[model samples]
Target: MSDRAPQPVERRLPTEESRQLVALVRDIVSKEIAPRAAEEEEAGRFPREVFTLLSESGLLGLPYGSDHGGGDQPYEVYLQVLEELAAARLTVGLGVSVHSLACHALAGYGTDEQRAAHLTEMLSGGLLGAYCLSEPASGSDAASLRTKAVRDGDDWVITGTKAWITHGGIADFCTVLARTGVEGPRGITAFLVPGDAEGLNAALPEKKMGMKGSPTAQLHFDGVRVGDDRRIGEEGQGFAIALSALDSGRLGIAACAIGVAQAALDEAVAYATDRRQFGRPIADFQGLRFMLADMATQIEAGRALYLEAARLRDAGEPFSRQAAMAKLFCTDAAMRVTTDAVQVLGGYGYTQDFPVERLMREAKVLQIVEGTNQIQRMVIARHLAGPETR
Candidate 1:
């Protein structure tokens, strides 16, 4: 690999403050995140302190409201910050995205009292969070989830397990969805459950192909109980809230995907230009040059797609179809671009000595998470052709 640092991506910011925010994020990534990413990921160590620093710096709350300690920045600006972070280290970027997703319920749907009580602390008080909607048996078909939350006087007792939860074991709070009335989407309700609540336990983290630094695990809510005040929105409204959150969350995933692809492209270009074959840099080869061109183009397209979706969201317009399209195209493009990047480096890319191999593995998961690419296609198709029926 070349010793040169990757050039920073050029961004169009709405204001000077947003420009400075991205600059600060780049500085943090260079000094704090990128330097330790390889070693920590190889060691499977979670960087909890890094998250604390992010919270303290106010980077954690950029897309939420300022009234409750958030930065109240536009989604377009916030997604750019996420892209910069993911380029350095995906664990941190995706962790931040999942944290924002976890906070969505209360910030958007919670009563004034609930927001006053918890939103400030969650957004800026160094607290981490998790979102619990997917279960072991329910991944894409989320409305089929089996977690039960029964009303018990003033409290709701929850029982069942949540699977594939980001920050599962260490989050300070969780936005959970559970069945409260019947057996479908309308029967579910959302709750802001404290992570340390009695009977809320996380199983051992799963070993993964990449991003070992971020823990993904199953959370067992063994009759976990919380006051009715913790409930978000009206009763039997959890699925709608979860779906709304996901529309935004998919954009986050898209941004992260583009970041990873950009990182891979940078590494490939560095290696191709520096490594000599037959007394000439491999990058001079027409085939390899075209490959690099394609990679760069794909990354740009993905970034543009996600940013468009984010701008739509910021304008208070419906963006679910665009979000799904962004998520699908960006993740699929990442997988392809990362694979081509590995090909660009030849043997070097296949080794742990380089980052492209890791990028390849990481790209695979982006296609699977935040509603899989297949699910994204279904969502887009629904928007175009209406819902599928038997």
Candidate 2:
């Protein structure tokens, strides 16, 4: 064998098709999403109509295969679209992310029969989805989840509570991870549970600090019966499937973080340029100018990281580390940028008059959800130094 080491393959830059997709998304964001965001935010109303509009535009299935009615767009393109949506409304962005996470089990590991029955509606309709993995006890440590799924002849009986479910009360379907074997990660299995299934209930939505339009509630499966056909992949593979989906889901969060930061920057730029102080626009002040520059820089950097991760995913490379890094860096950037954006608006930023306050609140949840920044740090640390360092 030759002694020369293998060279790393560089990812291709965004192609013409990708650029077109981005432009189309920008148009949709500007024309359809941007105008209604403020009204929806004020009313604390979830954007079912907007989602329906997106579905009609084929955005809901942006990254899936065309054979199943998906748009078959690249992850990079899909994430950019998500960034645009998030810039308009965090709830809508989150709805799309949760929907993608929900699609993972069915797309990656579902049997043909299961996909035939559900994937079509999931890809082509206004219906949304929720991923049910975290329990009251298991958030980052999902392998320790307590939900149970017992085989009952022709059906599987699922019983447990899933906590912090996005779209919990409003989703059309949920992909739930439940334990089938003895206690441990290996014991877990995934099941596709319909939202309207008997014995399944969602608690009243939780009061949250941000992303108010997005509902978060506890999903209770009390002896919920599902057909054996609804089980995704092999038994005892739920943990692996969940982790796989999370690896992908982290990119969505990273993109949303970028969007939040970008929105903050946009608001700050608009405000600073307009709001006068000391006989000049606040933006004319060097101090405010530097803050805006910093916010812009951070958003650009975060966007770069998430796009790199998405590129690695599209290239079929090992991307877990990249995804974790993107999630960590981008979310931290979002927190910082949004905080600075608030400072830019001064007192107005502190109040609900502008969107900065909401942006800040939305930025916070990006750090917590789709694996907390703490968990992200752990993941990145492990990747850098190896598990033996623990």
Candidate 1 overall lDDT versus native: 0.94
lDDT string for model 2 (265-307, tens) is 8788888878887998888999889998988888888888899
Q: Which lDDT tens digits does candidate 1 get at residues 1-390?
A: 568767889999999999999999988998999999988989999999999999999999999999999998999999999999998889999999999999999999998999999999999999999999999999999999999999999999999999999999999999999999998899999999998999999999999999999999999999999999999999999999999999999999999999999999899888888999999999999999999999999999999999999999999999999999999999999999999988988888899888889889998999999899999999999999999999
Indicate which candidate wins on TM-score.
Answer: 1
Clashing residue pair totals per candidate (backbone < 3 A): 0, 0
Model 2 misplacement above 4 A: 1-16, 388-390
Model 2 TM-score, 2 decimals: 0.94
Q: Each prediction's TM-score against the native?
A: 0.99, 0.94
Off by over 4 Å in 1: none
lDDT of 1 at 22: 93
